[model samples]
Target: MSVTKGLVKVIKLEELKPQIGKEVQVLDQTIAIFRLTNDEVRAVSNRCPHKNGPLAEGIVSGEFVFCPLHDWKISLTTGEVQKPDNGCITTYETAVIDGYVYIGEPIQHEKHDPSR
Candidate 1:
């Protein structure tokens, strides 16, 4: 439960398989970590904003994940739900250090504006 610069240790690099989601608890917040096929790591809220679906159990496609409950496409980078959907999920910062993964505080994204 060590936190360095607001980042807490989560999991090992090797333990997270490519194109697979790994669920981890950091600061009592459940997050889903994904290792892309290109070796990039991303962290997002484990539960989807829609239907409270388990995002970790969803399918990964590119930088988006389809909610297992209703296929709501969510962006791992921006935490925004795709078009036709109206919602947002929390995104977290992730870092890999010495083969271990660390997670930072939830990223504060800009609120959606309907005036657009």
Candidate 2:
């Protein structure tokens, strides 16, 4: 069992098979889960980082998800920008128990680099 802030319970785990995807809504945010060839499940904010486009409806490939809005490639694992103007997407810790996928609450990352 895991505990996190905001009580963001585990939603799902690596269920989306390669070449397929799934969407899960948590609170006011929707998350898109993609299963890569390496059998890794990556979840990202369902909304596009650019125009708030629904990323859950986007096409996912490999370690990247192509935004349906402007075709922005967002990385799943590192939450880094795979393309220009594309930025990090919020990710929640995922775990699997008895073949059930659980999306843990968002990890409260401490504020760093105060020099903004």
Candidate 3:
């Protein structure tokens, strides 16, 4: 599927397990989708800047995820480095319509979780 310039077709909302983390592939990019809370859903690039860690397999703690490859913590909401000085990966804008997720080509903030 051709990626919409400003949009990314990452995955279906049904493919995600609530309160669980899932990785969706978009071309060469891998996106990590997580249910942060009962009312929150977050998506971010799965690559950890500190060491190119696989973040999708990491553990979720509140608003952050601990990198499983190296134990680095990254915020799922802002895609910011929670406790390190390294840079952050590209985040995508996300939205849901009728249960399917539309990922923005760039990081876009979400005010509510559509999973509920």
Candidate number of the best TM-score: 1
Candidate 1 lDDT, 1-116, residue by residue in tens: 67888899878899998878988888778899999988889999899887899898889999999999999999999999998987888999889888888999889988878669
lDDT of each: 0.89, 0.65, 0.73
Which digits, one per residue and each the tens of the lDDT, describe model 2 over residues 12-102? 4444667566787766667776667876666677777788777777777777777888988876665555634646678766655555555
> Which pairs of residues have clashing backbones in candidate 3?
91-107, 92-106, 93-104, 93-106
- RMSD of candidate 1 to the true fold? 1.3
TM-score of 1: 0.93
Query: What is the lDDT, from 0 to 100, of the residue 67 in candidate 2?
Result: 81
Model 3 TM-score, 2 decimals: 0.75
User: How many residue pairs of model 3 clash at the backbone?
Assistant: 4
Off by over 4 Å in 1: 112-115
* Candidate 2 regions with alpha-carbon error over 4 angstroms: 1-15, 107-116
| RMSD per model, one decimal | 1.3, 4.6, 7.2
**Which model is ahead, 1 or 3, in terms of lDDT?**
1
